[model samples]
Target: MKRGDIIELIEDTTFYKKGKKAYFIGRSNFNPNKIEIVWVGEEQAYKDGDIDEFPARLFKQVEHGDR
Candidate 1:
């Protein structure tokens, strides 16, 4: 998806904490297939500056209705 989009972890659980919502920061500069995201919920495990990177295929853009 595009940058600034909200995405949800769907299939990839190895990196993401399943079901957590994240803000799409952007795709990896070194690899277009990967994306970077910042956790945005109350999950205390992820603190400030915490970021996650995963394959673009593993995330789905959150629809307006889903918000």
Candidate 2:
């Protein structure tokens, strides 16, 4: 997802970063091609496997007018 895309951390329910919980506001992407979402908080999960896959319905596309 691109910048400003609202995303929820479905996996790692116990994990949290930047004092936030559940939902996170997407700020950017580490790799646009890979569709990795980058938020304001630091990476909490150490391994890739630690992250659980979010269901299709959980992911909602937000309108980002311009870069």
lDDT of each: 0.72, 0.38
Q: Point out where model 2 deviates above 4 Å.
A: 2-5, 8-42, 46-49, 63-67
Clashes of 2: 0
- Minimum summed lDDT over a 10-residue window in model 2 is located at 19-28
Q: Which lDDT tens digits does candidate 2 get at residues 1-67?
A: 4544455543443444332222223332443223334333434652332333333333445444245
Residue 49 lDDT (model 2)? 26
Candidate 1 residue 64 C-alpha distance from true site, Å? 6.4
How big is the RMSD of model 1?
4.0
Model 1 residue runs over 4 Å out of place are 15-17, 42-49, 63-67
Q: Give the Cα-based TM-score of candidate 1 against the true structure.
A: 0.67
User: Per model, how many backbone clashes are there?
Assistant: 0, 0
In model 1, residue pairs whose N, Cα or C atoms come closer than 3 Å (at least 3 residues apart or on different chains), thus clashing, are: none
